[model samples]
Target: MKISLQINASPYQHQAADSAWHFIQAAILSGHDICRVFFYHDGVFNALRDSRPPGDERDVVKRWSELHAKHGVDLVVCVSSAQRRGLLEQTVAKKLGGYQSALADGFRIAGLGLLMEALIDADRHITFGD
Candidate 1:
């Protein structure tokens, strides 16, 4: 199945983001396909490359990168939402002179139009947050 997981909450404030990762891993292990992951609202923080967690806390950003590399997952962040939260990819951040690079290596900066296309083309759309 082609699964599109939408995350709409910040990574630190909720467990949905973590759960979504686990679910994706398991689904992939079980021979399922993850179509794409849409990070909206505060969930765009998950793609931030400079997110530093305490030693005891889990590294959600690293996990996301791993998922992307391992599964060829298309991690799409909403353009408007990312601009509001200041999530920039490395190239964009360098060109635009931002202090931080929010998008990880495998993630891409996209618009809601892509999300709409995914919704239309994806086999299953699962939202992980409110």
Candidate 2:
């Protein structure tokens, strides 16, 4: 099955991000294809490159990065949402004089068109959080 995920909440403050990660892992293990993972609203925070969770806690952002690295998943952060949260892409950041390394590895900043494309192409479009 082809699946795409939409995440709308911040990591740590809610279980959405963690749950989505676990679900993605399980789905892949079951031989499913994850077409894309779209981060919107507060969920855009999951793509922050400098997120440093305490040693005892699971680094959700790093986990996402690793997942993308291992599985070649398309991790996309909504451009508007990311900008609203000050999570600028490299080019945008450089142009705006903002932090250029705001996003983690394997994640790209894009528009809702990408999300719509995922929804159209995937067999299932699952959403996490509000």
- lDDT score of model 1? 0.86
Q: Which stretches of candidate 2 lie over 4 Å from their true place?
A: none
C-alpha RMSD values across all candidates: 1.7, 0.8
* Candidate whose TM-score is highest: 2
Model 1 worst lDDT run, 10 consecutive residues: 98-107
The alpha-carbon lDDT assigned to residue 56 of candidate 2 equals 96
lDDT (tens digit, per residue) of candidate 1 on 10-78: 888998898899899888998888989999998888888877899898899888888888778999988
Estimate every model's Cα lDDT from 0 to 1: 0.86, 0.93
Q: Assess candidate 2 and give its TM-score to the true structure.
A: 0.97
For candidate 2, lDDT tens digit of each residue in 9-115? 99988899989999998999999999999999999999989999899988998999899889999999999999998888888888889557699999998999999
